[model samples]
Target: MHPREATAARLLKISAGNAYDPDVDIDWDAPQPPGIMYAPQERLSLFGTPLWDALTPDQRVELSKHEVASIASIGIWFEVLLMRMLLRHVTGLDPRSAHVQYALTEIGDECRHSIMFGRMISAFGAPAYQPAAVHRALGRYLGATAGGIQTFAAALIAEEILDALQREAMADDSLQPLVRMVSRIHVVEEARHIKFARDELARQVAGSSKPRRLYCQIVVARAAYTVTHSLINPQAYAAVGLDPARAGAAAWANPRFRETLRWAGSRVTTYLQELGLVEGPARPVWRAAALL
Candidate 1:
């Protein structure tokens, strides 16, 4: 069998043993802890900024809750987009192949996850925090066209960033109970998905010619920029009573926050480098997004 098929088979075995139903597993009835953060304190965009220092503790917690929920909302949007992309790619494949089967299983997992995120947003009383209107329209166009290694690698950017933040939240004792559960469930399942993406991406890169690799690199960089830049909605600050314009500018330009975003991106960057996807042309795009 091809290495891609072999990797897919291995992932299928893991999925069979570890797949989850968030609806059945999470206890939605428990009272989510109020007066506590919705994510780890440091993961908040303005965490170390002067604006963060100026907020009252109650306001900080409130903003953290909304910010975390907004991120989860973005997760839902990306998950839905990627699932459609995956399904579209596999639709013409041999149904008997492990690659096709694994794609179907991963889509099932994403469906549950998208539902879980929607539930979490409503449970926490957060507004439907979406990306800017422009991004939503762009996502639809990209979802239809991002079909190859670019799709998987771009998906990794979102998954790994969220995984970093969620891992922090899951370990924090003071975050809301609902947040902890969501973090835990997503972290566990995403591990398998990440593995599958990495394996498939490496397989594709190993075989493609220089021109094909270059094409993939450019497209992946653009997609990565779009996904990473859209994660934190500046309006999330306004929702909690801060001046969105000022706060968003501060968060983007803050040294500590830029470092945090870069750190969150480091793992993916290293992998892309190993795959020869982080060439000179792509570096500018990644750096512009503060992801390099």
Candidate 2:
């Protein structure tokens, strides 16, 4: 039996006892706060830039609202991809096994999260912010071929980054109630999923040969770059009355944003390193992505 079977069984028990329904948990009919930011000021990509100083209060709040919506939309996109990878990975497992059951439970949670994100975006009146065409194609490839340590670790990385952001949003009284509620729901559910992925990744790494481990390190690092880069779409800036091209450039070069990426990536990278998935070949990509 795999090393993580016990971990899966325990998580399955926890899920059975405390799963949430976003439809019932989040009051969709509740009034959204008018002209309030959806995230903490410090989490804004251009928070420390001159462009940020030039913006009026209403514009800043609008930016936060759209930015948060884009983040939730991206969460949906990644959830769909991870669900496919998880389902494929568990295809041949025994139907009654805890591992397979927990995988399905994770998928069920993601489905609810996606629906919640969709409703949240609509309620905020933001346009759908999808990944670029090239990124979508790359995601399709990863979802199909990536399994074992690579699949779970990549999902964990994505979840952790969003978790960091949502944790802050959930606690900041300056933000809208709708945003905080959604963030709270996601954070609580995703914590269990993250634990399951981390455990599975460690077990998979322990079983892999050196060459296979190296391959996953490089591939998963590339996937990490894609996920970090795509979290916020450039079009989100246009919604706040800024030129997307100029704002994109400014945000990309912003030291604060780069710092945020590095800080958010550190925990996942450290864990990946411990699992032998952060070797020499992967280091440069991580650096270039500003995640190192």
Candidate 3:
């Protein structure tokens, strides 16, 4: 078996002791009162936007479904990536055992996250959409690459993006308690993952050549774009019985989408700036994307 797969299996074994199955773990009978999960003002970008108000009740429901699926899919991908990293660490290819172990714990946390999300879909009777092809390809490429620092950087970028969304979700007091709980749990664990990723990136970049640094920056930037664009998948809309093409087009064109991207980019840019990774032409692009 591949080294990463082996490591993932071992971690799964250790953490599987108290595994919670979605079928039996969650409170599916929990009450869901009829009201907006989040207030209009709670959504930073969509608040008072003409486009947002134009959405029908069904459309809004579809959008909410998309949001939950997006978060769950990304969470699963990150767990798999963490498993790969653990394999590298165990083989002595990387010396960051503590960080890798912490990430493994997070992976276990995400397993529960996936279950929660899946259960949410089951409760709502919405079909689950798969991740976008582009995003899946990007994740596969990142996972297939062999290098500790590179993997760490990819993971860092991902965690930073997630942190941005979680912050927004947590700030929205109008969100359902169950939704808020999931966001809170994710934010807590991601805080540690982000710290580990940033520290590792800084350590790796400190003595790197100019060319290597530039390469790393490019990789990180590409990963960010890949993730951001993936959020606009049409399948998510279709899964919830909405018109995929029209809804996706409207969603992609919506200013709220841009705002979501900005929210995600800002967190990434902040970390890059703190690490002194921003340089040359790429700095302006990163800044513009964040500040947009």
**Top-lDDT candidate index:** 2
TM-score of each: 0.95, 0.97, 0.74
Count backbone clashes in candidate 1: 0
The candidate 3 region of ten consecutive residues with least summed lDDT is 38-47
lDDT of 1 at 127: 78
- What TM-score does candidate 1 reach? 0.95
Q: lDDT tens string, model 3, 1-292?
A: 7444344345445454544454464456877556555222333233245545776765665566556655566556656765675466445434344444555565566567666766665665545556677767767777776355566666766677767777777777776655665566667656655655565567677768888877766666666566555544566655446576776666656676677667676766666767655666555545444332
Order by lDDT, highest first:
2, 1, 3
Best by TM-score: 2
Count the clashes in each prediction: 0, 0, 0
- What overall lDDT goes with each candidate model? 0.84, 0.87, 0.60
Residue 261 error, candidate 1, Å: 1.0
- Order of quality (TM-score): 2, 1, 3
Native-to-model Cα distance after best TM-score fit, residue 84 in candidate 3, in Å? 2.4
Q: 9-35 in candidate 1: lDDT tens per residue?
A: 988998889876877888888886668
Q: lDDT for model 2, please.
A: 0.87
Instruction: Give the distance in Å from residue 71's predicted Cα in candidate 2 to where it truly belongs.
Output: 0.8
**What is candidate 3's local distance difference test score?**
0.60
